[model samples]
Target: MKLGLKIKTAREEKGLTQNDLVKISGVSRASLQLYEADKGNITLDNLEKIANALDYEVVHFLSSNVVPQSKKTCPPICPSIEKNMSPNMSLNNICEFIENDSPLPPTQSNNSVRIPVYDEVYASAGQGFINDEHITQHIELDKGFLRSYFGLTSFLDLSIITARGDSMLPAVPENCQIIVQKGTPREGQICVTRIDDELYVKRLQKRPKYKLISDNKSYDDIELEGENYEILGIVVGLFQKIP
Candidate 1:
């Protein structure tokens, strides 16, 4: 039987309804339905919880006898290339693989590419001295280039920058690649800011007065009004590079 059918059988044997499983498992009602229907991926943690609730070993719930469907085949590898290439190849080698596979050049398209920039500065960087005129070389990019560079949506005008300080850590960590969109700040959006000649990244909390909050507990919140700050751009995503 399929995974979904197995789950349904198990639930029915236990005399439990989807709502009852939802309450017991602390999973949402929709998610419980998906689990029983086998329409969604269940984490190992959730699977364990479900097994415990149903009084079964985790493996017992799976269809061990069922065989998975076979995948479609691809072309055979080039023996010459395979023999010459190392098991551990660099990014350049991977790009060369793409180049060899297709007739198109890599740089033909203008897409947004993730470029590493300086880390954000907070605390010591005053609002009065923040400078927007900081000269930096920005390369024009295409969607594919941008997506490959930052590992983000290829169609969006997005680029990644590393966070320099711990002010936004836990949520936005230091040295994390923060995805930025060049646009006006919406209310309650996370953004990069320049104030008093210094640059910082914080979530923009607009109440009766504007406030900037750091995700890290060590950093204090900042309040600004009038000319104290300017929104550089809104932050849409973030990621960390594993060494």
Candidate 2:
């Protein structure tokens, strides 16, 4: 049963009217009505208030069978390519080979395959060839190798792109290439953001309100609310090509 329905059922079983529950819970009457009608779209704080008022634990209103979405798994590295890799091979060279060569299908093995690096392509942040943007680089490595090399087992999908704008300077200078990963941004995590069609890379802060911070004190933090902003991705790594 949905949480709303469960809450309504429990309240009915306790022989409490919505108004009585509101009085006990200190929750607004409209909120109590919403709860009983199974339309409880409330925040965690409000939910706690309702639970306290009902004389029931918060867990009692939740479905026991709820399962979270599984984390996406990385494709296996190709053994055929692994055999040819030399100890002296740099990350750039491996990327080149993966982009240039065609190998076995991903379903055949647990080996690494190259993930194509396409240009800008309207990524939710970072810099790249905008619309007709071309591929500037291709990174190839087994997921295991990348995890070991970066010392980050929690890394998700990684995409290479150049940084744009002076908004996130000093810490992440313009033109610096970055590797972005798909995941939730923790407080203080540097992330790429999409705010009303504009992109920015900034330090993220999540309070009752969201804020985008910059290392340069001159730049003010951008507060985000409603549907105007979203976190595109977290920056996991950076690289700079030498001439």
Best by TM-score: 2
Clashing pairs in 2: 76-110, 76-111, 76-112, 77-111, 77-112, 78-111, 78-112, 120-129
RMSD of each: 16.2, 19.8
lDDT of candidate 1 vs native? 0.49
Summarize candidate 2's per-residue lDDT along 148-217 as a digit string, tens digits.
4445565345665556556666667555556677678999888877665455678888986789888767
TM-score of each: 0.41, 0.47
Count of clashes, each model:
19, 8
Of candidate 2, the 10-residue stretch with the lowest lDDT total is: 81-90
- Give the CA lDDT, 0 to 100, for residue 91 in model 2: 17
Deviation in Å, model 2, residue 228 alpha carbon: 2.0
